[model samples]
Target chain A: MQSLVIVAHGSHLNPESSAPTYDHADTIRATGAFDEVRTGFWKEEPHFREVLRTVEGDEIYVVPLFVSEGYFTEQVIPRELRLAGWDVSEWDSDGLSADQATLVAEDIDREVHYCGPVGTHRAMTDVIVRRAESVTDDPDVGEGFGLAVVGHGTERNENSAKAIEYHADRIAERDRFDEVKALYMDEDPEVDDLPEHFESDDVVLVPLFIADGYHTQEDIPEDVGLCEDHTEGYDVPETVDGTRIWYAGAVGTEPLMADVVLERAADAGADLGTALDDVRETTRVATGD
Target chain B: MAEPTSDATDEGEASGDAPETDPEAPEIDLPADAFDAVLDALDDRDPGEPLRFEGFSVERDDEGEYVLADGDSSTPLDERDLHEELSERAPAVTDWYAFERVVGEFGPRRAFLRWIEDADGETVATRYAALAEGIERAWGELKITATVTDRGERRYDVRHADDAGVPVDELEAHEDPLDARKLVTYDEKGRYRPLKTAPSLAGGWVFPDLGPRDLYETVETIYPATVANWHREREGGLDVTHWRETMERQSGIYGVVKTWDRGEGHEHVNWVAEACCDDSQCLKRREWEYDDETDLDVDGGDGAFPCREPCSVVVSAARKWTRLESEQPRTYEFDLTPSEKEQVEAIIDAVADGRIDEIREADTKEGANRYRTRFLRAKLFDDEGNLGGVPTEPDEE
Candidate 1:
């Protein structure tokens, strides 16, 4: 039997950090697809290093629960999950042909197969579209609202911007909203300037983040003029300057994210040459979507 | 005289016999409260254990009341209970003043506090720290654990995650699953092997050294640069297959330079490289490239050419340059032999252990240029090679 492990960069304080990743794992397991499914985190307990020892499978599929491909996804995860002492670049099918490979085997490293994060999947577009629609059902709300995919874009890296573009294009294709834009905490499209980009009476801004952290509660809202005005009654007016903007939950906040995780498992399993298509097909059939 | 002698003898015999002490009568006793007092002391000393004691009489009072005392008192005590009492007295949570005093009286210790919510004082729950300052202030109702002074520091397994007992399905669905990268396998020659670490790009992409390129691709993926599509020209470039073909055929520095450019509109490129003139070794040949307005600039000189003048002196200088230029932010991939990697790792360990001086002073054979440079730079030695102003200890402040 094969095992699938999903590694998340969970926050020590935020309960929602690993929510999406684990939720996905649960959904996959509910289908009785894989023999075992487990979780581990970098900032949280049972750390990234010890993840390998927690399972026993002929083949293991590792799917990173990261929003965008960044340093953690690239250098840190690979280094931490590297087979004992073996180099990641040189490992092969027949296995390591060097002293390092021998040392790794002797050390009892787990067989690992990693898949791309769920953020990169084309299917994820469906989640964003549905989220936008639920926020503003104003038949003209799609045109009146500007869709801002708020991401945690850092100044040091441009690769983080790729997810926003991927998501933006996906949402733009639906034609559900007039303006689909990308905004960052550190980089361009400052949250404050979002009000300037649209002529619409109201805007519905969706954050493409995975958890409700400082960005969701404090930064993103503060960036746009969503400050609570004590004088304007308790009602959070869904529109700004006749531009109605509704906030949707993070991508990881979706309850159905578990299905995406199952999709990742299927992808990883396929990569490892143990195709579990029948199990996934069953899910599609059962859901009858 | 004989009659009086018999009477005296009778009296003496009676006195010596002393009423042949009644066999059934008890000997001695004490204040009734004494028994209760001793039992109370035993109960106080050991609350959970069963109490056992015996009383003995030593003498009789004038009224025939016995004088008794507690003797052979052996109260079986529960050590675990006693230890618990000791632990409770020296709680982990204390005022800053008390904490300072504790550390001084005994030694430094790790103290943990269980946070209790306001609704139910008895219930403890983990809360996110809104700011770092909140941790230092007075905590909420807490259940603390701390070792007593003079005993030793106590080790605690801090439960860091939510124990509300999330269902296994919820756990796997949202959490980072276990060993997602199952890297367990070997070949005939015994080398560590990855299932597959190749780049599978969707759109057109081209670069040199596919191995390193793919590795960089993975690196780029792991650490993506979310460059906004400034041009707005949707999809004019070649698909991923053709771009990879271009990278495969390209060779020399110029080959990479020429092949990297995408036409004006929707033109986007990122470069990565590995070597340079800073080491003073790669003077033989310099590697460089120019496709679009890239952020690819050699650190030593304004343009790539002038900086890598004697680049020909260095072996594989052009290739190294290409790799460096191809990286996102002009990153370099030092092609160190495995032994070199091991050496660097050893130096890292030494520095970590506060033994930087050992590496700094080691002979040329043991401490190579790379090791020496890293140590000196890490130690913050001045340009003149003076260590006076440099910090010798690790920085905690």
Candidate 2:
């Protein structure tokens, strides 16, 4: 039997942090692809340390539903998953880093294929572009609107901004949008500086986050002037400082993300078998099939 | 237990003596694979030896076919057909897979279900019927009810114990177990529940249908590792980090917790445990004491689950108290009447026991009542909110 374990950062304060992970797990489970689809959390129950006990399969595929290949994906996940020699303490004095590549460890009882996080996958670029296009009604919205990919960056890890910059550069190379810029929540070119960074009057801000938690729902909307009241939801195409801001939901919530997770699993050499087509047939909207 | 067996015996007598050879034997609807797994497990044991687990015993008869009996039964052994006996004795035994799953898994779910079955102290058939009728168990402040679904699968419902009688429609229903995290973050009074195991969980919400795994996950979300720790302690495997060891591991801003261990015979640790680890303060029974060697005077509480170590709330509060304890001793003199001194002590006791909320404003007879407290304040306290017109600190002049 084969299994897929989606690991995400759950929150003690907010329920929304783990919503997307559960949604994707449900969608994936409905396809009947893997024998089992389970979820683990860093801050919640069935913690990463004991998540493996829930899996009954000998061949397991673990996909981190995080937005970046930073501290969690690189160190904490591997350490907690007990992936062979990746058992070094997260706060180790030696400062050694776990391998960030698609890792497959057979040292444990099962063959655990630890895939790269879904947010860092190449398919996430399509998810970001789709999110930006989704908020507007224009058939050719990208031609005139600037796209700002908002990421929760940190000064502690430079790799936190890599996925956002990679997606931004990739989208910029496509030349479909007038401009594409990468923005961060902590680093330079913060989410609040979206207006100053974009040349287009109408700009779209797409949060490259794994969940519609405090960052996507409150912080990004308030920073872009879309949310006047913190308790209320925001509308798209809201005017912020004379610039029309079109805000999209977090990229991770997109239905296409289910496909991205499978892609990450496939990249890590998970045997999708014949069920892979069923998953794409049910979840993929971009294919227009 | 006697009631179900009597009922089964009545059904058998109603069917007559040739019940084994009766053409209309009740269908044995046990899951094929799960029964085989049970058979496989039994096969591992000695040939004639019965495998006993959670109020049920399974073994093979002389014909080499499987025979299951209630471990609690005192009846004589008979080589009856498995189908007729099972259908007559335990009609609710369709979902053997659920039993297999719970017994096969080596974790909290298995331990919890086994505990539930053993606690019932009934025959397997009677327990199955009770589960079908929805038997409720209390885990901390949560009410967990396990019911056999129409498909012969076990479905668990979890809600606050206070909301046990409330209809499902009256409460918010959750599908995912992770939603319990948000439910446990605050109390009904909208106060943040700093300790997850505190008995302040908000009610009017229920996860009315969960699988065994999801039920375990939901309970864990609400109370973290209480079940696992409880089970571990029962099995003599709980790695308890006592107050001293836990405090010594504190670093950075919380490093002051280590200073609390002044070798004063752990009297201060007893105070910390008394203030934080009580049944009223936390739902987990305090298993950790001053150290592995010394035990505290305060009771560990009658909680269903055990706390393996000092929680973050205890550590954080201990740090604050440590800093306060380091201050130089000072003496302040105040004169009060006998009743006033007793009233002050009553006020402190009321606050410490979290009974201030129970003291009604209209019940002015109570010493801690708002009107009585106000009357005392008016008669004694000065305008600076000082007790008995005495300043805590001496004037600079």
Candidate 3:
């Protein structure tokens, strides 16, 4: 049997950070798919080094629960796991990045399959729709709203912005709303331009991130002028332009991504039919969905 | 022998044995009403767990009595009905300022409310991922999983097409059942026309698009077993043959390439392919035609776009495989002198019968990487007994 070690970029200040990854690992383990499903993080206890030593399995699969291929995926993760691939490259997307197969070391006694970041999968668009629909409250009013997909855009890489735009285009193609646009924290069509971007005053902004870290909690709400007090913003929406802007939690934290994780394993050759069935049964018992 | 030996009272309290005086509670406000008010506060705490107050405990019994326990002494505080007395001593919190101070007095609720105050709340993905997650788990119950097609259309592969929960049979009659794409029509301005009202197009074709709400409602109303179409199983695992057939018809971004290990010096050759890149306009998705015999693009695009670069997916994979063939150390198959080979074979045979974890316990060799310290450490072999090699894209129909 194989083991899966999901590596997440956790936060010390925020306890909620890295929560989704751990929750996902639990669901996958319950499916009885892999020999073991363990989670390790950079900021939290049972860090990567400790996790690597404790988890048991001959065939280990390490998946990064990040939105895009950037600093953490390329640098911090490899250094912590002590993976033996090129550390840096000319392009941020270059080198042993997420969503690909990379051998850890030449003579490691076990086979290690390193997978891509969770945020890049196209199926994620569905989760985004769920987030948007949740706070829409009134589907009648939502019919006239605009969707703004906000991301942590860096001036350095175009790939980050490309992912945001790609999802926005797909959501727009669905024609659920009157208008849809992709905006960024550090780039053009900034989130502050919300009122100007939409003809309908109502808007729904779903953060395209893996966790509700500093950015989703503080930066986004502050930019939208919807912060409740000095510090944090809840998943609930606030009014902007006299219209409600339903803010959703990060997209990467959803349970549907667990299926994607299994898909990653199956792509690397771990059979998951039995586990998938078991997991579905368990979920049915839990929610009757 | 002034007092008969009594089990109810602490024997050491000889001077304070009188029932008129109460036991010492925590030092603070001295009014008797305030103390009773604190006891009355037991109504707020959950009954399953006992709440400790200083050295004493306040808990609600299963019979609905608020019992205050001081060591072995148990007082049914609520049975005594002291709310009127306690209400007078407890601080009034009618105003906002008084309420703030009163809240400060609440140790556990304050902490809980503090967390609620600070919480950034759940992300949209979490709420929705849950919805999508439930659908996947209950796929058999729903009779279908609503999935996004490769072309990004949302549809379902109803378990029984004719007896589907949705009007799928009627919907499929207008469009190709195999294609599963919605029928859409455009108005003169090119805006999408509504299916319910749009006029017939050429050949009497009609716009029959289903909105997000309509599709979900229809599925909830009728579909029997909706399945999620995952990336690896792009066809929701229901139609593998057809899915594979479709994949084979399109251009792929990567192909398994055959290469020789020049560095290994064992006359080794291997077959490799690019990890399947799903980019719609993947660098390898060329319009140029490949030779049926050679499996390589023999002709430049006469009109269609052809593949250009080796691609990040292929280049990275190629780099990895090449490194594996060249670097570090070999564990599964290693070169040894003819004389030492027989002893190694004996060791290998001894370890083969048991599980890898158990066999690794008695061995004394340090592995070549960071992760080996935790693993049972064994190499996988194919049916032919050869060491397992690089992963290849799954076979198509």
> For every model shown, what is its TM-score relative to the native structure?
0.38, 0.68, 0.39
* Fraction of the native A-B contacts that model 3 recovers: 0.00
- DockQ, candidate 2, comes to 0.14
Model 3 over residues A7-27: C-alpha lDDT tens digits?
886753455676688678878
Candidate numbers sorted by lDDT from highest down: 2, 3, 1
At residue B249, candidate 3 shows an lDDT of 26
| Best-performing candidate as measured by DockQ | 2
Give candidate 3 misplaced runs (Cα > 4 Å). A86-98, A105-108, A137-142, A228-235, A274-289, B1-397
Query: RMSD in angstroms, candidate 1?
Result: 29.3
- Residue lDDT tens for model 2, B174-293: 998878867976677777665677778888899998987788878877877677677667778776778888788656577778987888788888888888887778777788988888
Least well predicted 10-residue stretch by lDDT in candidate 1 chain A? A93-102
Which residues of candidate 1, in runs, are more than 4 Å off? A84-108, A134-145, A154-156, A228-237, A271-289, B1-397
What is the TM-score of chain A, computed separately for every candidate? Answer: 0.77, 0.86, 0.83
How much is the lDDT of residue B369 in candidate 3?
Answer: 20
DockQ of each: 0.02, 0.14, 0.02
Q: For candidate 3, what is the TM-score?
A: 0.39
* Highest lDDT against the true fold, candidate: 2
Is model 1 an incorrect, acceptable, medium or high docking prediction?
Answer: incorrect
